[model samples]
Target: MKTKERKQEDKINRDLAENIKQVKKVFQDCSDVIYREIQLSEHIQGLLVYIEGIIKVEDVQQHILRPLIEGLAQHPQADGEIYPLSFTRVSLSQAQSATDWPAVINGVLTANVAIFVEGMDEVLLFSVKGGSRRSVTEPQTEAVIRGPREGFTESLRINTALIRFKIKTEKLKLLDMVIGKVTKTDVALAYIEGLAEENLIADVKERLENIDIDGILESGYIEEWIEDNPSSPFPQMQYSERPDSVAAQLLEGRVAIFVDGTPFVLIAPVTLWQLLQASEDYYERFFISNMIRWIRFFFLFLALFLPSLYIAVTTFHQDMLPSTLILSIAASREAIPFPALVEAFIMEISFEALREAGIRLPKTVGQAVSILGALVIGQAAVQAGIVSAPMVIVVSLTGIASFTVPRFGLAVTVRMLRFPIMLLASAFGLFGIVIGAVWIVVHLTQLKSFGVPYMNGIAPYVPEDTKDIFSRVPMWKMKKRPSDASRANMQRIGKSRPLGSDSNEGW
Candidate 1:
């Protein structure tokens, strides 16, 4: 049965009318598909098919239709040689010939004009790429004060070109493939040639090719499908909208996956440290960067453990606190009906809901609603004697600390794990928090991103990678790419100038 179906597959027919009939049948309900008939000469006719809004109408009018209409006086023979000879008179640079219906259909769908002629068994596809798309703008998610202002747009070629502008070298290889059975989304795997490991590239390629989804509308779809562990709450791959961030990752021997319609590109084999560091970290001075990085690390702990610690300390280990502070907290909670754990849950949940509402609301009102809502509700709750004042302060601090993490994905994971840690602390005090921390550490140590460890620099303990893991050292002192991802060619910098040297002595 499969053999018979293969043998009966549709091919381009020599009869122009029959081909048009088949194409119209396939696109029966698609009103956007436009079909135009052109008279080439007294004996032969041609059919032009393309989608309405995607193709450039001006190019089709000037380059294709005008040339063919004017060349009618030449009066060529109606042979296989005639179509090839006539196409030369046109000025379009990107053109290809397809012998089957599938290829022709795909070409027309992807911003190409398909030309069908009489007495020809193939269709000519001319690329006239144009459409209304979002222009390049600053990335709203990964905004920075000291970095490039331009962000990636939705167009795949434009995104790749942006990266190319940063890394101007032939060694930056972009391997393209089409995925999704219905959407046929264009995806490109980008990495530097000598920097990235051969096996790592092959593994990424194999994982992508193995996906058999119906459609991919965004990079997140690909992220969900090709990630190392779908069940893990921690993100194995980092997604960024900034071209400089993606280019930086590629230079570090990581693979960047670009999907057609999303501004965010997925970078594979990312470590926990990479997600914690922001693009501005590299752009700023090393001393300032190190200080800010240390502050971010301190707040990261607060974001995850502040609520749980408050519960554990107030409920089980009150003696650990200073007597005056403990007395103040006790006096504040005198009128509260709920226990410490229950009060913390109420405040945390309410705060999270307000934050989510702010995000989901319109931009003009979202920030106002989030800020005002937090203030109004916290004040009302305190006056109503529902939640203690200290609990409110802790929840507010936690929310603020969460914003400090550079990567939204990792921040979300930390937010999600907070509740369970709170529950653990309520049941078993500080020891419960210890258990949860140990479990998370174990998971991070064991998790792999495209065969590279999630905590590559810390758990595996590569001495060379430590310079940029916890604190980024000066750019001049860094002389090697990360060893975990780019084992083949590790050196990325040469000898640096001495600290006080005025002469141009080193690169």
Candidate 2:
């Protein structure tokens, strides 16, 4: 059965009737598939095959149909040979000829008009890539005050064009591939030919080619398949809706994976520092950027350990707090029946549920619902003596801190790791928190993203790369890309120059 099917798909039949029969059989019950027969001349006939709603109807009428009908009427073929319609008549730039049934079917499915001429064993494919897709708009998730407002859309070509607008150079290469057995989704791997490591690009391509899936509807599907460590809770590859963010990563010698039908593009060989940093960091002045980054760092810790710390301090080491503060906390919990651990768990779980609910609900009511729900539930829980007020405050702060982290993937990972740390604190107090932190650091050090260490510069202690890690130095001061991802052509900037002369300082 497989052999018969393969033989049928191997080549196109010279007989137009037989070819149409096979195509119609394959596309049977597919209402969107359109087949229109056109007489090229008195002796020659051709069939135009395409899928509706994907190809441009106006283009078909103006460029393909009308032009072919008029052009063929003017030049009658005496030899009865089919004229090359795609080369001589069609205005479309993207045109190809295929000699197999599978190629013709694939082209027709992917917004291309396939012309099957009578007595010819080849099909002419003209790309008319058109569909109603979401336009480029401000990214909903990764909004910035100082950077480019335009974000990637669901269209793959539009996303690539956006990146190309930022980095206008021939050296910026985008290698395209078709993945998924059924969907045949278009995926592009982008990188600078000289800046990105050759080995890294090869490895990424190999992993992507190895994907044996039926369909890839989103970038997340590719992310899961190509990442180095799937078991790690921490995201091995960072995904971003902002084209500026992806362009910045490319400039830093990292490669980006653009999957069709998703605004989020995945950046490979990501580090913990890259995930923590936002696109606006470079857009703003160094001083302000550094200040905001420090705040984000502080909140990152709070997001991970605030509830656990509260559980540990209240349950185990009450003496660690100031006497007055400890007394206030104890008094708040006096009316509460549950212990600190139980109280903390209840508040944390409720806050997470509310947050998820807010995200799942429509935008207009989502924020309102989450905010009101948290406030009402916290107040009622405190008044009802179910959870202490301090526990509520801690959970609220933790939730707020999670939002401060720029990347949603990293923020989610922090939120997930929070519960485990909280459980540890409940079991072993501060010691457990310390142990959890150590384990995380160890895992991070061992983790890799496309052969680059997840902790990269910090764990290995590369002095050159540290310039952008803990602090945001002036762009001129940094002369090289991160050492882990880019192996050659490391110098990205020239020597630093003073902005003003000492003599003109007064001015």
TM-score of each: 0.96, 0.96
lDDT, candidates in the order shown: 0.90, 0.89
lDDT of 1 by residue, 19-94 (tens): 9999999899999999999887777788999999988899999988897787641346565346453345778899
Clashing pairs for predicted structure model 1, backbone only: none
- TM-score of the candidate numbered 1? 0.96
Number of clashing residue pairs in every model? 0, 0
Model 2 is weakest, by summed lDDT over 10 consecutive residues, at: 498-507
C-alpha lDDT of residue 446 in model 1:
94
Candidate 2: segments with Cα more than 4 A from true spot:
1-9, 73-78, 496-498, 501-507
